[model samples]
Target: MRDPDLDELRAELEEFAQPEKKASRSPREERIIAGFEEIQRFVDEHGRAPRHGEDRDIFERLYAVRLDRIRKLEDCRTLLAPLDRQGLLSGAGTTADAGSDDMDEDELAAELGTINGFEITELRHVRPSAEKRAAEEIASRQRCEDFSKFKPLFQKVQEELDAGVRETRPFELKAEIRPGAWFIVGGQKAYVADMGEVFTNDQGRSDARLRVIFDNGTESNMLMRSLQRALNKDEAGRRITEPVAGPLFSDQHGDEDQASGTIYVLRSKSDLPLVAENRDLVHKIGVTNMSVEQRIAGARLQPTFLMADVEVVATYKLFNINRSRLEKLIHRIFDPARLDIEIRDRFGNPVVPREWFLVPLSAIDEAIRKIRDGTIAGYVYDPQSAQLVRRGTE
Candidate 1:
């Protein structure tokens, strides 16, 4: 029951079919024929015919196998059949449809419906999870990208230093003697000759010792001034100057502002030997009743704050203990916001938050002994109850 016109079209197509040849055609001819054949096949498969109107040039290239050879009329008919079925060609395959190749933007817009301007803008600004993931991946990738660019410059400087090239000089010294001491005996020593020789050998030695003592005192004074300036620049010194003044206990009657505080400055125990001359001065600051300002004025000294008794209550371990837990064990037990938790070592060193606590010397010794014996894991205190609780015991 197939259409007679379609049957005729198939017969025409068979007639145009070229016999398979043992040898291949020239590359140029093959390329041209392949291009036109693809178009013809597309037309036939879709039940549409090929158009020869604007595509005349393309057809000519495909038919340019040999100018001398007779053109196959049946091949032309077969090529035109599909165009005729699709109404794309006027006569089988002579002309294309009215609007086949023309695409109107307005028409397409009408078919797809109007796009909202706001929606477009929103899409551009919005970032999906995938986009964030991609950005993180890109950043991580860039961090490890290349170090070869900087390696050469680094290696050159290292090599020069290794070769004994002088890169820097950190210190310099200048010296001078007192004018009167310049001429102790003769012509060049005439500066000191004006003075009578008042010393025997022993006296001269004593005079030298006196000069040494004066020089040592002067040097010590200068060094202390420098150290004070350095301490003023330290972080702890700054914090002490800006102490977070707050009320002590609920019933305490003393003016919070009247609370006396001191910065206990001490060189490390290991630095004791190096600072033997200042040992007496340091101890004096700790035991004396002089205010920090008065002490500094009297000795021209700068002191570091004593951080020994500060207790740190970390938020993470706030719940691990019982009665002495930071804040409280349960509701109505402690108000975290009201209670101040600071950590310090036994000898009173101000440790960073989450770091080891500095408690009184007495507490530290007991804590260490208990820890060594595996009796406790940590130390906690309840200010309200005035009690200390070990980690493992109730």
Candidate 2:
């Protein structure tokens, strides 16, 4: 106890050792420490740091402000020194920080990478789920990356369509939908590029994800069910397929090939009051590819001819005619003046004749001429005037 030099040597050794660190902080330091810790917890939850952009949630913006103040405050930085495991403190108080005001809008957007150009300039839409899917199917379109491979296929398809080998039919619900199929949608021909996996929903309906490329330099990632719905709603939608037979129209030679169909106009002879009263105006019009005599042989036995004797009013030889199409056109032209006459057949059963019309033969002759001249489509039969007039004039 009397050794002063030895005690002084011991005290000097103690001073040379490292001092112990502070274990606690003051109230002011603790307040800043709590605020900074809250922000750190947010970063731990969301993979990125908080941002002050207007697109962010209000709570996120408030946390972003708190984080900014905490970073700039020296006391707060010192209080939370042990929590900086990701080196976030090194970049604090700089323009490169997440919530820094010195950063430009473009720079901040590039950092987040959330919105694209399409979403930025678009407005919101509300619709039914089926209609919404259809809208997205058309609206969310893009240029296909690998369309070069499909160029040749489209060219060949066009060639086949021109040659009459491939034709379009009405889109059906039960039709086979698969990859590499072509369909008419939104007035454009779309080709199914690839089909993804087949998935079933809660309702047990099957569907597939598809990449549909259009002729207008656009494409979409659509579902099979969506395509079906869109096509069913569209009046013009059709499926493109190659038929087994060859072209519908081909050049023919010789007199036998040049033979035209026979257009026979017959007047029905009936004892009924309605038929006898308008026998002169009511005429039964028919077209046949075979001989007119052979066609009239079964006229008396059939109910279509009123089951009575028939008078041959006029016969014109149709040249190079489509018999079925010609008959339909003739029926449509006289549809307005169709005569509603009923007569009892040989068995005394009441029957109505459908083909009899109370129209002038001259008008019928004029319609046939207009059809032959390729101008019938421009006209419509006016019931009031009992004459053919320009379609829009009516």
Report lDDT (CA) for all predictions.
Answer: 0.27, 0.66
Give the per-residue Cα lDDT of candidate 2 at 247: 18
What's model 2's overall lDDT? 0.66
Q: Could you give candidate 1's per-residue lDDT for residues 159-255 as a string of tens digits?
A: 3223211122211211112212211111011111122222333223211111100111111111111222323333332111000122211123334
Best by lDDT: 2
Candidate 1's TM-score reads 0.13
**lDDT (Cα, tens digit) per residue for candidate 2, span 200-306:** 85458888888888887777787787788778887999988742222122333346444447778898886767778888878898888888788888677777788
- Find the candidate with the highest TM-score and give its number: 2
Q: Each model's RMSD to truth, in Å?
A: 33.7, 19.7
